[model samples]
Target: MPHTKTSDGVRIAYQVRGDGPPLVLLAGQANDHHWWDDVRDDFSDVRSTVTIDYRGTGESDKPHLPYSVERFADDVVAVLDELAVHRADVYGTSMGGRVAQCLAARHTQRVRALVLGCTSPGGQHGIERSGEVRRSLIQSDPEEARQALLKLMYTPAWLAMHPGPYHTLGDRSMPAHARRGHLVASNGHDAWDALPGIVAPTLVLHGTDDLLNPVANAPLMAARIPGARLQLIQGARHAYFEECRDLASPLVLDFLDQKAPLR
Candidate 1:
């Protein structure tokens, strides 16, 4: 139930968990801090994980103004500043990864390490979702949208085996306007030129079977960011963090624990 006011006067709601070096968890479009609920505790043993609801989602103030990746990055910094955190490791998934790129590029000193999951640096180079997938995501019906998204998020086998999570996902729905705002912001993000500027030791995690953001983008990101490592989870899809957390968590924890060479 904690909140911070950004420079734009928007209130961003965030939660802190565990104790250790700070690790900020940035969720995908239209998702709140609750998106990290299933995996936040996984890092509690070694990290003080911070999760926040981006403006227009969750408990945060949803201002009726244009939202951009830069704005999202600034919101993150505002939360960090309010928490008295000078610097922290950052992990961003999907659209959050786009914001994370902006954060590392704009506020280099405030980020210790970077983790980009199932995301891409937008613009001409980035691949977008198919028309079918896009249609499903932007559907007016919450249940319809959730079901459509579930298909893109998980492999068919995973979805078949785990019906409970899919149902749980349906129960967590975002407002239509908020979802549209998030999609617009994500669509406008372009960090293709900024990737090379990131100095933080970076890790790009992606699922081989990711339909939303292709796995190919992962290597491109790793190659662009200096000293970045890429880890591709075979047979997994877009929501690997949720569907395959047992495998993804260790790789993330190990990378965060590794010492970054003095720059």
Candidate 2:
């Protein structure tokens, strides 16, 4: 139950788990550290882990103000600094991935490796779904939202085949403050040109059927980072970790394990 103060004085809560080299987990939009409940223990074999609740999410302090990607990146740095960790293998999903990308670009020394999951390069906007559809989606129930979100992240057949697990995602909810921050952060996200500047050893993962942020985003990211490798999990969705933990965990653990020597 430890917390760190960001430069702006917001308290960011984080938890250290397992035992090995350090691996920091950055959750997706509106998601708290609990989102990692399923996969957190899976990586224990390879590294010690730190799961963080971003400034506006989870147990972290949330203030009314404009949320920027830069601020989120700073929050990550502040946590690492408070923990006395000079370097760590960073794992970010969706909005969290955007923060990790910014961290690698601005604070190269602090990040030893990176795992960017179901993310996109900012310049290229995703999803031109009907405005009526989009409006309806915002007002939609969590279950409907979850179904739509899962569909956007994975293919149709995959969702049809895996109702139990996908339904579990809809049941998980975020705090009100986190929901607000997610709207602000997501609205502000756009990083098309900055990808080339990220220097950390990076892994870009996406699902071919991801409708929210398509698989094309993966290559777009890979093409920019010097030697970053791309892994497209077939039939998976944006919540790839939840949908395909067996496949995703090993890939992430392998990447983190390989970076232990450098860290």
Candidate 3:
């Protein structure tokens, strides 16, 4: 429940747990710290993970403005500074992965390694959701919004088996006043221009069936970043971590454990 004050004095909330090499987890867009709870136990054996709620989500302060990925990246920098963690492995999912890539590319000293989950290189992927899906997400009802998001993000079987997490995920949909901003920032995000600059060891995890952010993004990211490795989770979708934590967690841990060639 600890919080850090960003350069602009916004209160950014975060939590640190477990013990090992430090791993910072950036949750997906609209998601909060709890997004990692189901996977943390799997990581505890190999990492000390820190999870945070971005400015407009979870327990963090939801300011009306300054919620772009750049600001969110700065918020992340502030959190690391507050924790006295000069360098740590950084993992991000969805929008969080974009923020993580931004941090590694812009603030190289702060990120030791990078893991991007179910995200994209942004503008390159030809995959675009239909207007109906976008309309359902922007609708008034949180439950409907949540369902629509899950439909795009998770496979049908995964949605059926984990009804509880999907319900909890509903709470993260766009808030009424910030709905427009959220859409603009997310849909407008294009990290392809920046991916080539990330020098940290990189691993891109994508789902073969990811609709919201297509799996095609993985190859684009891996090819651009020197020595980056791309892994595709078959039968998984955009919300693969939430749907297949058991399979995904171990792959992530193993990737982070890989030793970079000696300089």
- Per-residue alpha-carbon lDDT of model 1 for 113-173, expressed as tens digits? 9999999988988877678777777899978887777888887787888775442242145
Clashes of 3: 0
Worst 10 residues of 1 by lDDT: 164-173
What are the per-residue Cα lDDT tens digits for candidate 3 across 1-263? 79998878778889988888889988776677887777777877767788888776767777788457777788888988998888889889987788888888889888888999877666645346557766877789977876777787778886677666442253345475454555556666777777788889999998898777778778888898889988899989787876778788888888878855211
Q: After superposition, how far is residue 12 of candidate 2 from its true place, in Å?
A: 0.6
The 0-to-1 C-alpha lDDT of every candidate, in the order given, reads 0.86, 0.76, 0.78
How much lDDT does candidate 1 score? Answer: 0.86
Ordered by lDDT, highest first, the candidates read: 1, 3, 2
Per-model TM against the reference: 0.92, 0.87, 0.89
Write one digit per residue (lDDT tens) for candidate 2, span 1-263.
89998878899899998787788887777667877886788876667888887766667887776687788888888888988899888888877788888888889899899999888766544333346546645754866865566556556665677664432232134557566766678767777667788888999988776656566778878888889999999888677876788999899888766664844
Candidate 1: residue pairs that collide? none
What does the lDDT come to for candidate 2? 0.76
Best by TM-score: 1
RMSD of every prediction: 2.5, 2.9, 2.8
